[model samples]
Target chain A: MTVNRQIHLVSRPQGEPSAANFKLVEAAVPALTEGQVLVRNHYLSLDPYMRGRMNEGKSYAAPQPLDAVMIGGTVGEVVDSKNDHFKVGDKVVGMGGWQEYQLVDANQRGVLQKVDTTHIPLSAYLGAVGMPGVTGWYGLVKIIDPKPGETVVVSAASGAVGGAVGQLAKARGARAVGLAGGPDKCRQVVEELGFDACIDYKQHPDVKSLSTALKEACPKGIDGYFENVGGIILDAVMLRANAFSRIAMCGMISGYNGEPIPMQYPQLILSNRMKIEGFIVSEHMEVWPEALKELGTLVATGKFKYRETVADGIASAPEAFLGLLKGKNFGKQLVKLI
Target chain B: MTVNRQIHLVSRPQGEPSAANFKLVEAAVPALTEGQVLVRNHYLSLDPYMRGRMNEGKSYAAPQPLDAVMIGGTVGEVVDSKNDHFKVGDKVVGMGGWQEYQLVDANQRGVLQKVDTTHIPLSAYLGAVGMPGVTGWYGLVKIIDPKPGETVVVSAASGAVGGAVGQLAKARGARAVGLAGGPDKCRQVVEELGFDACIDYKQHPDVKSLSTALKEACPKGIDGYFENVGGIILDAVMLRANAFSRIAMCGMISGYNGEPIPMQYPQLILSNRMKIEGFIVSEHMEVWPEALKELGTLVATGKFKYRETVADGIASAPEAFLGLLKGKNFGKQLVKLI
Candidate 1:
């Protein structure tokens, strides 16, 4: 019988999670029931939203139960299967938790076809060509519905979701502007992603000045805003929103750790007739296939690109998650298992 | 030659406007040019929006210039006509300002048909059937779109716009709740305007308690919010909004005086996925006829009712306006001049 090494929730986090909050333990692998497939994790995705799940609070999703295995999405290979749909050596993606081995229902897991590494890296499924890619696609196409001449701005521009948003918006013939933490990421976003402009928030400390810079980049004012980092950046972009502006709020990474900043100029919302909508990616799971298909095509054409900060083992997952919160991850953060 | 009695803007107010801000002067009325019609003022519509016009600050409309006639909409009778469409004794509505006599372009003014006073008073056009009525109607029907099972809440529910909003929302089959300053106005809102409930802010010092009361009245949570007085009331309502709630931001009368009380809850917006949209009734004037037709039918059927605080003569307009700021008016505040 195969033994599974799992990281379970040791304790709930107060503000930012630390390694102590997680405990690694070896447990006996359960027998595969009917319609279940055993998975050996190849790569586990570490996301910023996991920080929210670590805390015991009400959110779009329920908080991870105390003492339960740490919840996460994973790319794995089917080692054994009782289900007809999944066979041995089948590559799959599912909520496999922070575990070396997991038994998931075949219907609950997605069978990802083995992609040619020469064409596109297998890790793209965890980053640019995966959930993050689909998140950006759904927001840009479905929520924002940006027109050809309109200007679109996205925060966390070099990160997985924001990078995809910037490229997709550009693909739609809309002018794309990005806001990143540092100069290097900003340059990478503009030069590599083909965004019209990028604002480095670290160099431009004044929010109003950054807003003016963004306005200069987008002379007509922002028509669509794909918000990932929310805080002063959100406050800045809000000032430059034109009438009938659509703000697709995907995540509020900036304010997740701290107390929320009081909105300074909400009257702008009244004056500009702006529409801000917040949504979790899972809420649009049914329409995810459409987003994935489009994203897959873009990736296959080499028009879309993504970076990953992959940790060596499951023990490094917490550090990778912490790095994501600190804006240290260039794109998607992932934990690789041996 | 007709002499015109004009009220000029003397000084901009620091806070609540006093008599010192206005100066009344008499001037010989100019001869009507081509397309100009000589108007003798009859009824002047005093509204809260006029307060914004007095301040030398940014708003939807340009602020009144120093020493210029205080701008206002007036129901008047055409004394002399130099235009083809208008004739002597023709009742019309135009931007006549605060004056006894004025000359306006006939094309710039709308002809006001003299309706049966027995059916509804002529001044009802200034209140329930005019700008205020249209403001409430458009905000509720177009912006809020309250469903039958939805809960609708309006601030300043005893005032012109708010009273109309509560009544219209009730007619549209939504549970209506109002927030007013005093207990008397709160009682009047529930008893007269037929609101499901009314919260007296003065009596309920704790905003959270007031919110709880509003929540109890609206068990399903607020689906549509018709905001007139912004600030703490808005803060309370924002907390109670369910997912996909719509806020029709009409006026922020609470913050009209100067800087508002600093708001402490913007995270509620991201959490609830609420939408706050600001609109001016004038923006959707094309749909005015349809709104008026619906509102008129409601009034005719005795299903909708309106109350007006009529201040006799033009001199009382300032005091009435100040009273409106203090929530002294039971409904629409008007100045009747003969």
Candidate 2:
């Protein structure tokens, strides 16, 4: 129990990540300091953003250093606390990385916060009501700002952030359309997530084909678009976008592996007079409280639905993360440690 | 004179327009009726926007109808009037098209407007205090909206709209950078237009080379961009754009001839978190009054400088317009009708 198992990034991947890029190591957990708290991580979040951190390229965030525990979001229980804020057995959320345990400086701001899991599940604190949820909220509410009866489209509709975007749009009385990978995920997006329509993107691989499906799903044309996957999905959406459409650029997971995905018709941006903006959610901390409160209430009351794909242990994190990048995960990919 | 010599669009061009596309025709002047005002146009504005109308393709404005006098902005003196608002010899600005004379229904809104020409010259009404100036005002003040000390970049800096963009950015306390075609134009952009720095894009044909020049010119990176010429210029500007930069998509003349000028690195929009919005100045009529007032004052006081390349007569309009599209025009291209 004193030994902590962690996965460290050994080498950066050229294109797609592989097993050899990561290494497993065991180290003894050090005793807690005067202001430090010891936490045993129960679940680790695996996101497509992790793929970006693995590269040495300049991005919104710094690259994850080699031979360091992979950077991630985690939910855990505080076993020992030196600070009054976090008590023992309190479930908290923090950037605990891909490790079995975490030693957090309790005095540090934004390091750790106790979450109420009385209604919402503990693992869900790392999913909804967390970073991903807030990301979706900011992109939709701030950038998109879709009007009632406007049609809003989101790529990767089965994922955590995309699901939240569709639900938020629906709540605002806008038509929420989705684009997902396979037939199964597409079905879940419309049936479970309650999106008005979901198109199976795999069935329509090219821009023209996908655009045809999008037009059918959204008869009035796309008024707002939440972009998670770039390339053909973005190209297709641009074709169907209405005049004065708003496109909130979130993640470009489709181009994360380093292929150049150019906009085939950027001139449409000028012709249609659209507004496209990209944003990083962490840069906007002001919206977190409001976004989390609404997300937590909806999730707790079952008004908002979400799914999880949990891999058993920390050793399975790298594979789970790779699966997430490949769209193998049906929903929020999480690594269960406890 | 009872005859009106007018240039008409006889045929739409396949790619670049030539003399064969236009025809000179003569028509008898009609007798004045109720609410009618007849004007002898002195100057016809030969703007790049007219080139867009020559194509049958969809654009911000309607296509130039074949066998009709070409649509344009003109400043002239009223020869006769039946309306109480306008009198003979009154200097005015209106959409008089490419003709020696115009019969305007003064009762209709936005048709005929009386001008003082006390401080501002009659010809200046078509260039600095007209649509081109308002176009620049909308992009710089309304769209780009640069804060003090931020850097702004405008391409085709010697052109009327581009010249105004750089000047407005300077007025707002922003560092104005420019990208012009040749050395002569580049020199005028910095020396006459007062841009902080100007890069001659002709020296650097490729994105990498142009981006290198842009880096030297804009040390802090581009904070706001006014796009006039798209394709490589836009691609080069995208490379140097700072995070959260605002790009006003005013024109894409480089691709106006019907070619796929794809944005080579669309992912950069996401990585840099930029806002790219397209707008047509005509669509926003609300800003015209305030824009024209400031523009009229600036030009009248000689604080604002402009150059015009005037063709001998309306018969030379077709060749002069073709030259403007090929970057041969020194500044604002105009046709002398009287």
Q: What is the C-alpha RMSD of each candidate to the true structure, in Å?
A: 2.6, 1.3
Candidate 1 lDDT over residue span B196-265, tens digit each: 8998877656668777877787788899999887777788887788887888888888777787544466
- The lDDT values for all models are 0.81, 0.92
Q: What is the DockQ of the complex in model 2?
A: 0.87
Backbone clashes under 3 angstroms, per model: 0, 0
Regions of model 2 farther than 4 Å from truth = none
If scored against the real structure, what TM-score would every candidate get?
A: 0.93, 0.98
Q: How close is candidate 2 to the true structure, as a TM-score?
A: 0.98
In model 1, residue pairs whose N, Cα or C atoms come closer than 3 Å (at least 3 residues apart or on different chains), thus clashing, are none
**Model 1's A-chain: what TM-score?**
0.94
Residues B9-115 of candidate 2 have per-residue lDDT tens digits of 99999987899999999998999999999999999998887878899966767899999999999999999999999999999999999999999999999898889
Scoring only the A-chain of each prediction against the true A-chain gives TM-scores of 0.94, 0.99
Question: Candidate 2 at residue B308, lDDT?
Answer: 85
